[model samples]
Target chain A: MSTKITNKEQVEAFLESYDTFLFDCDGVLWSGTHLLPHVVETIELLRSRGKRLIFVTNNSTKSRKAYTGKFAKFGITVSENEIFGSAYSSAVYLSKVLNFPKDKKVLVVGEKGIEEELESVGINYIGGTDPAYNVEATDASLASLARDESIGAVLCGLDLHLNYYKISKALLQIQDPNCHFLATNIDSTFPSAGRLLPGAGTIVGTLITSSGRTPVALGKPSDEMMNCVKEAYHLDPSKTCMVGDRLNTDMKFGEKGGLGTFMVLTGVDKEETILGTNPLVTPKFYADRLGLLYELLQNN
Target chain B: MSTKITNKEQVEAFLESYDTFLFDCDGVLWSGTHLLPHVVETIELLRSRGKRLIFVTNNSTKSRKAYTGKFAKFGITVSENEIFGSAYSSAVYLSKVLNFPKDKKVLVVGEKGIEEELESVGINYIGGTDPAYNVEATDASLASLARDESIGAVLCGLDLHLNYYKISKALLQIQDPNCHFLATNIDSTFPSAGRLLPGAGTIVGTLITSSGRTPVALGKPSDEMMNCVKEAYHLDPSKTCMVGDRLNTDMKFGEKGGLGTFMVLTGVDKEETILGTNPLVTPKFYADRLGLLYELLQNN
Candidate 1:
């Protein structure tokens, strides 16, 4: 049976048990643009309790700087260093972990966020947000497409500007045995404004099928992202707790990282999913909403 | 043991057995812009033998009319009626088999070939080479994307002009439970000019992942395309032979359709693939090249 962190004592004890709190933003903190009530207060309370706050999000469309701005808009102050978006994580993994060559550039099939992250990491890249690559290809142009030996990697994300020209270029680039394939995340759907849209996985999925190659995905639920987070923050998994609304990405991520998990009923999953038999992921604690923690803090 | 027809008597006997012949163009008849030697003469010889020759190809980028032009360019005469390109097959299946409602439109994610085929079949369609759908989506424009209730189906093919707008529109249109999802083909690669390029499967794959739905694929190796061919040509499977270079697509297609299969070594597959133990597909006959039959016709 999972412990329900409802009362002041339960919430206080839960907070005391963990020194670090990793949060998934979209569902637990807010749903779309509407902020979930008391989330700001709860986050403040965690900070006041000396909890190391790290915002871990699978949304690869935004860079860490962009997330900081979003946080500022929500009246919560957060620095770029505190945000670990999939885009930023991917850039870090490529630059630091893989030691990507300085002479070669990454072929990006994503948005500005990915480009920004790659730039921040001092990695040269091509294709993302380029007007030249965002157009339809004709037979004449296709024949004229020259292979660039400088493209050492193909990085993919959710690109609203996805076109055959970009896909074809990436396909051609990745055919080289030396070129690496990487993806930000494979979340099948993007939850926005209370609706599901096609996510980065759709783009990556097509590349996987076309190239007959599986990319190293850097995001939640992937051990690679967890490794990046652990190395960057020097996090002790035993002292960390993952708080999120989703079971698949957040809860699975926490479990895989050997951290305590808390599930909130404000996102993709419901209480029935937790209570159901043969659950894919079981959270250590369950809360009605993130706001419940704020009430516990106040009452305590 | 598979007999290799190297001489005149064996080729004459093989040709005389099958009344109808299905050929895969890229490998058997030609390789890219350069037509294989003796292919034209062999085709003419088959025509003289009164064999019903059908050019069945998974290349959805070109319409039957375009194929007729290509055949003419290769110094061979073929009519649109004798061509069964995946684009034409899909259109025929949608119009003749499904009896699609005349009032609703098909949301197409493909090239002008698919559009032309749909037009020939009198099926109304949106998207495809539409200039409006060939660009990126903005946050403001994404909000403005509205559902078209008149869309009854989503057809995917080899779309060189693929954009997020088209994919998003198709995703929205297919959300209607009444809408059908169809694909021209799921060929992973297109062999052109001695190289492999991304095929229609890559386009359909992304849509499948995004929509969480599998489309009814109409192409080689799929029973749906076989049914369309059967209905249109009134083929007697027992007296028909499917000849091509690939074992998986062509031989499997022939075997599945209850027709005799002939493997040619001039395309994607080699003799080693056919001679190997536990082959995925077993063809009834094996030839070094399509031109072997031409030599037999001249010698006999």
Candidate 2:
């Protein structure tokens, strides 16, 4: 049943037959805005071959609209649907499985992107709404929810307003075995515009550390997210291709979906990582960038 | 030569000579607010025996004032000089070693404790005034600093607001060989009120990870902190007993100082850890809590 082959030739053959393509934004396309020279042309070339392109990023700090804007800045015209971020996928999954609670008492403590996702998903996002953004207010609001009986489930995502107290409140509520604890993703950290920022994963980690319990991760490399890609795109596993930079997130997504994975060494993951550390999601195709990948395709 | 006595009695005989006690605050005395029953009495008992006590925490979050206040709230009275948290030590070390520039600019991303320490050390903290308080502000301020040449060192500690972007910026500053990098402590993570919070070690992890450069750690288990404790108290290591929860931090502190390390499984480290993990500092005496320790002391 596992059609996923590690052989380069077999994967290339599969890519030739696939109708849909998935690309990881960071490493595969460009390493955070320094565009590889021929990437746009390569996508255009793939489009000419009747391949559907989907750009996915595990970084949930940015919403799809933000991605669209960033892509616009990067000179790539990507539709909101064509781009799938972990935030988007997380939101979509929570909406479907979590039977939108009526109490709508959610203690949201993530970035603007996560807040946007929650509101879009029909879940009542409730917590400290300080324009000044006070952690004290966030703490009290969350603690109030924890003490409340109406609050059903606790939804967690990447919160830019980070702290120990914020997570303390969320764990206070969700620690009850009756409640469902769903996380945006399991990425412990992310590279942002700042120095280094804790991701939704860190928040999720907070909950796990406090309660000694794991939350249901709704985003990338999780079986659920992979299925989302499969069902929506109607992916023929043998023919589909996944191109990404990170071996764990992007490449693993391909592995789960039984597609050929291409690792581009442009972003977070180094060249050595593909060969050295993670053996689970090793890429079938290794390229410097997506454009370079297309160049190899063309030269051959 | 290593001590030849194997039985627990020899440990008691050895500890009888020590005149000063170096105690790690969190894991040994208590895990957060809940105190080990005999902790106060044991300290009182030790004090009655004419032993000097210094309570230390590797956690860089709060200052001596905060710890003093926290202990006061728990109905314990201890002097400021008798306390040694990583934040205080780092500040003291930085003030002595690092040459200040004309602007007095340092980018800070930790909590109140680390802030107090930095101020005490005469470090003019810049970047977002709120240490990892707001994401947008934290990100914007840090991103600006990453590109700024005026900024000297990115001073970091245990900021519960830890994330990827901030670490990225710290790395950016550290990437230049000209920049000085300092970590408050090297504890990978810490147990907070609810969950596992990223420790000062994780902050250091970002620098070592991105720039492939190790930092100068000024906190616990680092000979600097140990030496600071010894000189401040005028104590003989052979006669003193070091008590704490963690084998790595507290026990190691005792071990490195050549003091008798007694581990109490009441805080961050458990008895399971003693049995499983190879502690760098092996406690001459090990027990469940201060009460058990008291019983052992009487019998031995």
On lDDT, the candidate that comes out on top is: 1
For each candidate, the alpha-carbon lDDT, in order, equals 0.88, 0.67
Please provide TM-scores, in order, for all candidate models, with all chains considered together. Answer: 0.97, 0.70
* Candidate 2: tens digits of C-alpha lDDT, residues A1-300: 123333446435645766878887765566544766788888887787788998877767678887788887877788988987776776776677566666656666566676676677776665533343344433244334334556666767766554445555566667677767777677755555423444566556556655656777767778777776676567788877787767778788788778877776666776666666546666776765566545556553
Tell me the tens digit of each residue's lDDT in model 2 across B117-144.
Answer: 7777678775433644344445456556
TM-score of chain A of each: 0.97, 0.83
Which TM-score value belongs to model 1?
0.97
Clashing pairs in 1: none
Candidate 1: regions farther than 4 A off: none
Tens-place lDDT per residue, model 1, B146-237, is 78888889999988888777777787776666789999999987875555678899988888888788899999989999999988999999
* Candidate 1 chain B: 10-residue stretch with minimal lDDT: B189-198
